[model samples]
Target: MNKKTSSFLWNLRQLNLNICPFGSSSIRRMMKGDHLELQKPKITYQNSILKNLLLLQSLQKPLLSVRFFCQGVLVFQLEGSEIQKRRLNTLTSASVGKLLYPRQLSSDSQCFFMSDTTPHLAVDGPKKMMVPLEHDLSQKEKQLDFVKHRHLIKHCNSMSDVLDIFSKFPRFSSCNYFISMWKIAKNMSEDQKRFERQLLYEHPAFNQLCDQVMKEAKTVKLQQVIFTLYALIKIGIPQNTYLVQVLLRVVQERINECDETCLSVLSRTLEAMGKSKNVDALRAGLRLLVDKQIWTLEHILTLQTMMKCIGKDAPYPLKKKIEIKALKELDKFSPVNSQHMFGALAALNHRSVILLNECSKMVAADIHGCPFWMLMSILQSCRDLQYQNLDLFTAIADYVTTTFDMWKMKQVLALLLVFESLRFRHIGLMNLFLKRVVDISQSLNQKEILCILHIYSSLNHICDSENQQFLEAITSALNTYLPKMSSFSLLKAVYCFCVLNHFPQEPFNQLFQENIINELLTSGTESERTEYMLHQVNACLELEGTSVLKSTAITLRECSSAPFRSHVDIEEMLLNLLENKRLFLKNVQLPHNYFVDFELRMDSKRSKVFPVSEADAFIAEPDIIRVALLCVSRSAFCFGTTHPRGGLGIKMRHLKALGFHVILVNTWEIKKLDMSLAVTFLKNKIFSQEAFPTAPGFAA
Candidate 1:
């Protein structure tokens, strides 16, 4: 049984039969022998019971002349002449074992016959009646034919069957036929489209047929199904406008139940549509996907393709509208919701010329933080192009200025650094950026002051003698801000100072006064102390060379009443200064522990070191003779050691004492000088070697 039939039977079994009809097969043969025979099989469950009842009714028709066969049994014995006399064949039997045809049973089954002896005997029986009905079997055949047509379409296995059905109907004439075909096409395997396309590509006739079906057809569902399928074909181009319009109409008509696949199809079709440069189709396709909330992978991918197609082709007004709409839509989804936003950004870049204005507004508003990083990356990436638009630049600059206004020092400094790095691109903007950095540095946050200082450090690299005025202006500004700032800020200031060490001493000495250096020493944490100490040492070493140490001792004499220890102990302070200086030398390769004192006993390792600048001359150059004489003078006055060359222990002192500008010379240049006699005097005649016993404090 069919599923529907079985289900119907299960529902019908609970009801009792009421006025069911029955008929005999011989009467059916007599009725149908002169009429059209029922072609279908009989409905067996009820047919056999109806047939037997008719036969019984016919057999009882001649029982009108009844006689008693037993005490309680009635026997009907009627001859043909008697039956004709009372019309017994025409009368229906009201008793059992009587034959009745369908029409004959209804006419006589209700008639009552009175027997003369039976009236005296008083025979009575229950009432029985039969009603005849007419049946039209053609309605059943029509219903079966409809069902059979549907079943055939459903199980169609070959293309010939589909083509035959298609040929049987006029183009778009039979709605039901087309609807059925649509359902079938929807159920067709995905490969069917590829197959159809292959057919179209390999066979010109099929292509024409598909085009007619897609473009000029009146069948709406069929049109959409064919158009979407054709789009899926990956073959020759079809009419993009028709496909997009149909899909969009279908999506809108079926609102609240739109298929995601339809949205996806519309999206993929955009690539092909874009090749036509059909802006209408592009807009419609985007609107449909947005409407359906189907920002699927295909949708994003298609957007990327659409972006590439329309690169600079976007008109200003339309571009503005698209920007507003896209941002609003993206805001709805939150750009952070997915990484697809990166793709979206990439698309935006293609339309950047027109988008830059709207983008600037969005960025200036700063309501959405997600796109800021993206915008920054875009600016950096696009820097190489000469045509890099200024809308983006002005937007970023305006954003940084606003950040400065809002006291977002960290953000301002970050922007300043980016601008400074990109100064080579827009060279004219360098001064403006520097001025802004100077402004930010005035109120810079402790966390961000180092970054600003780093920007200055980079700026120094860019500044030449031609731009010396600007560099001097910046240096003067740093001098004012350095003392009151925190330790990290001071370290950053010192770093900036070291980077721009070419400045003259008057302004430099003003920077090194008690307040500035003390601020560095007192406010700086351990790490900052170490860092700045290294910065100072490297700068002073490069600037003064060996004479830096002698200047330190002379500076110590100015601090005479502060404290004094044995002159032999002065080396500790000197070592501390040199170690810290060595830490600041940039890119200089030195041995491990070359600057560290492994024997120092302080809990804080820095306590064993000192600022070499404090114990030596801060000079303009290295002079070997001047440094040697000064070293001799310091050893004679301070250490009083019996060495051949007086104070020869001071190696770099004589170099700077003779007014040498060491900045013009490198360390190796000074090293190759002829100092062999001086070296022997210092190593051998400078002192009588004495070895001590191995006790902690009792060496004699």
Candidate 2:
């Protein structure tokens, strides 16, 4: 290296490690090439970013580049000024090309691949003869409509701000518009990427762009074509099959011509394809192309993108191949990038604990530094594996509760669901959700409303003022949406009410209408949940003074039961209690297809067992207590917590409304008990007080 350049690099390396905490190994390896090579450094795309910094140091540079952005090797930011931001923007546009700077800005959390060598795929294949690049295409692109509308497009903040501009795309303007708008959109924060992509997908010009790109496929510049495909995906793809095939063909035809820069964008586009889960686009073989080209990729951005693309859908052999590659480049896999690999691994339906632990360590090591999205993914990874890490979850809870406002609605839903799956709860987060949900309740989609109903109901949220408002909003929204909701969804909505111990009379009135009831009965046969709801809804309605909604189409006895049973020992012990204390029937299936551990009818004061065949026959007699011995195993709970799952709670509620004095024989509490203790435990559950305990509030 020349003395001047060598001294500059030496100074960069000698910066205080305690302050920056970034390793320069990649930088050193990149810079070790001869000065001639240093002029055009062979570092991967991520390093190319740093190389831009090396050159742009002549313009201006910030210390540690604003919180040590190590390019997926455990880095974050401190928010630089507008000048530094502009300087960084220039550095990015100049480095990764214009199409990418925005995507890179969209979310730092995305998995990227990087190959130091940047090899083209299938070297042994014969190279095709190169066609001379079209001269007319370049000249025409300069005068495209985007150049004319550049001033107006620059001031466009949201996608709506540019709908008029998008509609005004002249005959030959799509390529420039696609390229320029993507660059402009790059300036949007990461969250807006999802929204704007949807808007662009809905625009008429998107179709025009697709047709235009297909017509110009052979003549347009390769980067323009590749980046346009990437942008089409970011905005969201229309259901256009031909467009995917045409783009796939262009990519295949241009495979050998792709350099590292081209491959970086290509790999990224493939990553988006995988994430978007466009079956047609993937079937177009761009996914297979990435698989074929996997060995050639060494860059972290490219590799992570490859892992992200493979996800769980890739076959076992390919997953193993990429897994080995990930392990080999483990250092390059940051907590965020490692998350993609973890997601892929978990999707295999196998828990790779070693990898799960490794990922946990990365996040735990810098839990405070992890972004909202990254923590959510880690929780998801834990959820998929059924892995429990209290420390990690606690750290995440601490961070998320304080910054609760930062989460998007769907992300918040996912996080809460993950927390439920993990059996972890944070009061602050729950309160925040309840409060936040009420504000946005009016705007939720049908699926989202159902999800909210499930979330709050399953969590067994107390009906505080905030929660009541949220539930009221949800139910009101459902009532408004009833005309549009499918018959099955109406059943689900009613079931959510039953789970919460209420009759959804308003919706139920509409639901019991002849046509909708028939629709639900016919369509509901295929689903276990639907079948359960059919019986439970009717039972709940009747117990609430409404008439039965069951029609001839419904067969109470013919409904499918889960066939799941409790442990044999637990069942035996519970039978012993019923036999020893009271005359009782063992293993009775209720009218609702619910299997009771033991069913024994008693007078209302529970002084003695009765021989009534049907428990409710004596319901009018205040002296009757319909005892249903429910053996609730740990599996029936929310996995790790003592709280019964929603289904269990629902069953208890149904039993209560049937005039049954529900007594829960917790499997865990009696697991270590002898027969005498088990009998005592059973007796206590029945005669504990005047009002028998229902649900998990059973005798201690």
Candidate 3:
């Protein structure tokens, strides 16, 4: 308790304070460990920086790092490139033990929970946890791969060259490159965009790619190189279209090397050109290589393929113009060059009027290069387009008639076109055209004669009363042709006669009486000989006089007894004609018959009529006389000809005219004829005594 004790105690207490609450050794050891622990974070920070730098170096960019500590103890480290690491470093403090950059690459900043006081490097201390950096790293990797693969990098060569390389691989071998190329191509300007996309076709780079695959790779699989180019072209390349055009030209130059395999590839590629921005360029290439003079059949076929691609979607006027130009070049082909001819025809099928007009010019030029078959091909094309243009038809008609000497078949087609044109409102031209045909036929042989007759019959369907003049014209033509020509002339005559008689029905009997028909029926060539006989019968049946039918029946009946009867199919045709005649008779009510019915004007009240002369009357005993009159009454009950009443009337009238008395008897006259008593009275009066009815009480 003394001063000395207090001083000693204070010094001891001070010494104890310096030492520690426990032992000095334990305190010193703890401080050393704390120092090591504090230094540990610096080592971690340096290592992390080095590791992050390595990662960033690999990425070729600067990066930032964030260090985290709990109560001055190192806990975790976050590292990222300068993109966000430096930003993260701004808010987080290493001294605070919680260091986080406010702008972090990942949502999660490097964070540390503090249990003891430690200086904060971050301005706003700590914050909500951010998303993991691992996610960010993964995302960046993917972006890198995509950018690398999805775009046409600067190192990439010309699309054509690239396509050529791809062509060495199998189909779809360059899919990755193709996809990349396509995306890049689509990104190009509107002009380049077209061909680029086309290049991306299944045969990628097809336009640019030399189709000549490596000789070593020749044995590779189907669609290998070709399909690769196809794909590349389809997905497309932006700057490669010119290269594409070049490639196409190269292929076209070496087109002979194309087999079906190559041709098939070319066909597909050309089809894609329809929508290509470089269509004109591609077409130019085709034209340049596939010139008309040296064009092979394959080239024509390729041209056809090109046409099909554009034909439908192309504007009609534009397509028509193109067709005109194409056909002009096509027409230079030789007739024997059937391949060109067929191709030209197929192409012209889409442009009928143009073809027809061109054909007319060729015909007018007296150019014999276009063979009959070729001209026929052109005319055949017109059929599909016939209704759209009449000038084409008229020109064709003129050509047919003018060129008939050169191509008979074309004439037939021309006539057909004319006939069709005439079917609607163009009869003048049709008649003129047909007349020319008829006139020409008459000058030609029987074959040509038959052709005209058939043509006339074909046109006869539209004939009416107004066109009856032409019918006579036709008849005249036939008469001239049939008599002049032999062989089938009889057949022609029969055909004409039947047509004229059934069709015109206008006074052909005069021609019939010329007796050429009778002469032919008697003797004509074996061909149509029976048909000639049938014609005579048909003509007679068609005549106004029944005498013709009587004569015809007798003639045919007599002919049946002859040698030719067994050779003819007479009964079948005759019966057919007879049935036709019967039908005609049923429909045709004669003027005389009309006079008897609706036109007849006898007095209504008169039951009996006086004949023109008394000689028309007849007398008889009462019963017999009554019967006669009843017969007359029955006959006077006129109606349709089918009625029997008229039959009896004619008979009674004849008898009456032959001096027989005929009392008029009808329903009303039945009673007047006589009751039994009157009959008895009449009998006694007429018979008198004895052998008669014993005087009915007037004495025997």
Tens digits of per-residue lDDT for model 3 on 583-624?
A: 111111221111010011011221122222221233222222
Tens digit of lDDT per residue, candidate 2, span 1-700? 2654665454355433432244557446655653222122222334333343333331223334423323222112223211111112222213333223323422121222221221244222212211111232233333332344355466576654555565654444345566556666767776787777778668776676656567666555677777778766665554356676566666676766665566677766765654333444453454566567777776766665555544555667776666666667777767666656555556455466666667666776676666666666667877777888666777677777777767687877888877877767666777787787788877888888888777766766554657556667777777778888888878788777777765545787777778887676667366666666778776665555344443322334467776756467755664565553335666777766677877777766664556555545666777767688888876666544667777787788777866677887788888788988886676667654664453112111
Q: What local lDDT does model 2 show for residue 127?
A: 20
Best by TM-score: 2
TM-score of each: 0.25, 0.51, 0.24
How do the residues 618-695 of candidate 1 rate in per-residue lDDT, one tens digit apiece?
A: 223221111111112221221122221211212222223323211111122223434543243322321123311211
Number of the candidate with higher lDDT, 1 or 3: 3
TM-score, candidate 3, is 0.24
- Choose the strongest candidate by lDDT: 2
- Model 3, stretches more than 4 Å misplaced? 1-256, 259-375, 382-426, 433-442, 461-489, 502-540, 543-550, 553-700
State the number of backbone clashes in model 1: 45
Q: Which stretches of candidate 1 lie over 4 Å from their true place?
A: 1-374, 379-413, 419-426, 436-449, 459-489, 502-537, 540-700
Q: Tally clashes: model 2.
A: 21
Ranking of candidates on TM-score, top first? 2, 1, 3
Worst lDDT window (10 residues) for model 1? 596-605
